[model samples]
Target: MTRIFNFSPGPAALPEPVLKQAQQELLNFRGLGVSVMEISHRGKEFMDVAEQAEADFRDLLQLPDNYHVFFMQGGASLQFSMVPLNLLGEKSTADYLNTGNWSTAAIKEARRLCDVNVVASSEDTNFDRIPALDTWKLSKDAAYLHITGNETIGGVEFHEYPDLGTTPLVSDMSSTLLSRPLDVEKFGVIYAGAQKNLGPAGMTIVVVRDDLVGLARANTPRLLDYQVYADSGSMANTPPTFAWYLCGLVFKWIKSLGGLTAMAEINSRKAKKLYAAIDESNYFTCPVAEADRSWMNIPFTLADAGRDGEFLELAKARGLLNLKGHRSVGGMRASIYNAVPEAAVDALIEFLREFEKREA
Candidate 1:
């Protein structure tokens, strides 16, 4: 059996051990005599998986008792709207930081529901760096201060979170969740699409402070209400049973690797190696600033844009697949998510050198 190094941003690579375990139990699912995909979400088999997933997740994040973890279906995009729908309370505006594509999208969705205050932005620089927190002009009575923990398309991340005295802080952590240790108490709410560092695309993980619940607007859909999901234990509907189960396995896999602290060290080392290769080479350039570069996604461009297609083709043939950057930005992007191994990064670096030599 052969598996190539996969670098696609979403639906990214998963821990190999977890994949192997799933393959071994795909049909039987630990003596249940049925695939997890075919079982009832309310049954003991799947319920146990759901409960364990929440517990392991809570352990990994050290979540406070005031926070409630909801395993919902809509991806992070849905939370963009739900954040305003549920948390807006009586405020007419929300503060948002426009960093890159994802942040911009979040802001766009939010604008539809309430008056949006773009507190600060790095769009002027094409999102090569995160805007300084001190420069943010937060509204006096805003609903919440929103930020994207990491921008996947632009390869920029915020290493330090901002402190919003009395206001609640909300973040879209889709691409960077679980990549490092986060202060669960710092943000009032945190949401992530499971595709990046978790299990798959169908699941969305939301950690909302208990106080933030029970405030949805009257017109909010029942499924979009945070309180409903929280009260129902994230089982308001059938839920994504198979995706939830897989995510539980991933949480266990992460625990086995010594939790986020260990994962953070590995991710930092991997990003350093890849960034070093880009910085030391004259043939490639990373647009994002050094301080703001993302540990998971590193987007770089060849000195000659004409060679982008050629580089991608050769890299794929050599077993490095899905290295293409997002269409909005034309270049090469290597998304080294939590499951991507260091050896794969080394292989990519080796290919970079070979390609540079051949093309130069």
Candidate 2:
């Protein structure tokens, strides 16, 4: 069997040990004699799983007592609407940072519910760089400032947190969550879809400050209301049991490997190696600014655009799967998430060298 290193952006690679553990318990989870997928989410066993998962995540993030972690069903996309629906209240305006496609989508959703002020934007620069924080035009009466911590499609990231003074800060951290350490106290809410560095596609993890829980609009649906989920422990409805279980394994795996600090060191080393390759080669170039480059997703282009398909084909033959970029971008993206081993990055570098030599 060919050993393939998957680099897909989401629904991406997961730790091998976690996968093996799931395989071992797939049909008979913890002597229950049924797949976790077949079990009731409200069952005591499942509740324990959910509780421990949340506890581990809180511990991993060093979450303060004021923060509440909720594992919900909707992807982070749903949070775009939920954020405004819950936090906007009587305020007619909110601030947004337009970093890339995801942030743009978030802004569009917020516009439907409130007067959105695009405080900072990189669209004029083709999403190649993060807008400088000093240039943002935050409104004095804005309800909250929303920013996408990492843009998956553009391969751009705000490595540092945005400052919005008294206005609450909300971030869509779908691609960057769990990839590194974060100061949980810096933001009012941080939400992530669970396919990148977490677990599967069905779960979204939200960490919201306790004080912000009861701010939902009067007509907000119970499911979309943060306060309801916070009050009920994210069990107001049936949750994605299997996905939650998988996330627990992932969190445990992260802990075994020394938590986010160690993970950040490894992720940084991986991105640096791949970016160094791209920057050094005349045949390849990365468009993002060095300061704003995403450690999880690195988008680069070939010097000769005509050879893009050829490069992808050769990369696939060598077991470097999913090296293609997002459809909107039309280039290559190597998403070196936590599960991607350093050896895989080294292998990719070797392939890049061989391919370039052949082209020359």
Candidate 3:
């Protein structure tokens, strides 16, 4: 069977090694004669898997003991509400930075729960760049400052984080989480959906500071409360056992590759290579500001937009799939997540040159 390169924005590509290992053990995991998906999440074997995944995650990030990691079921979209619900403790306003679609969606959700103070936004430029950090007008009495580390659709990323001092900082890092090393101590909370860099789509990883655990509003549902998951090892109810197991394998895979530092170097090179091809070619154009361009997702357009369909059809014929951009924003987007190989980027670059040469 032939496998094509996949560049989906979500439910993206995964490591072939991880897939093979899972396949070998799919039906009789640890000789239990049952698929890992059929096993009890609370059983001893699955518990061990859960523990080791968290440990490996902490090790890769060098997380401080003060933070608690929870492998919850809802994706980052749910966190848009959960963040304000749990963190808004007596305060009426929460500061937010609107970088792109995700951050804008977060702000829209937050306004429903409380007063949302938009500290700054780059919407004026159609999210081509992040607003300058010095221009942010932080609120003194804000509950927490929320940011999206990367925008999957618009292809903008925050290369540097803000220091909020006493105010809590929350981030939705669905596309950026495992791509590189992070300064965990600077934020009060970090959450990401597993689809991009971690594993599959069923699970969401949430890391919260100890102090922020019990701050959910009184009316918050147990399922929506961070404290509930923290209290029960993220097993307050049945968890996503199979997704958790796969993510654990991904964590091990990352560790084997020298952790986040190695991933960062490789990711940087991959992004830069593609960007250079785009920059040098008069046939292609990437609207994102150079400084804020995402290392994981690169969006670009042809000089003649009419040929987009031809480009996608040709790329598909070449076994380079999912090069289509998000619907809200039109163009081609190549999401080079952690599991995507460097060769795939090289292949894409080669195709770019070939297509441009033939069609330009």
Clash count list over all predictions: 0, 0, 0
| RMSD of model 1 against the true structure | 0.8
Give candidate 1 misplaced runs (Cα > 4 Å).
Answer: none
Which 10 residues in a row give candidate 2 its minimum summed lDDT?
158-167
lDDT (C-alpha, whole model) for all candidates: 0.93, 0.91, 0.94
Better of 1 and 2 by lDDT: 1
TM-score of 2: 0.98
Model 3: lowest-lDDT 10 consecutive positions: 157-166
Question: Residue-wise lDDT of candidate 1 within 1-360, one digit each (tens)?
Answer: 789999999989999998898899999987988899998899898899999999999999988899999999889999999999999998899999999999999999999999999999998999999988789998999989999999999999989898788799999999999999999888999999999998988999999999999999888789999989988999989999989988999999999999999999999999999999999898999999999999999999999999888898999899999999999999999999999999999999999999889976
Off by over 4 Å in 2: none
Q: What is the lDDT of residue 227 in candidate 1?
A: 89
lDDT of 2 by residue, 28-135 (tens): 989999988898888889989999998899889999999989898879989999898888777899999899999999998888899999998899899999898789
lDDT of 1 at 254: 93
- Candidate 3 residue-wise lDDT, 234-302, digit = tens: 999999899999999999999999999999999999999999999999899999999999999999999
Kindly report which residue pairs in candidate 2 clash with one another.
none
Q: Which has the higher TM-score value, candidate number 2 or candidate number 3?
A: 3
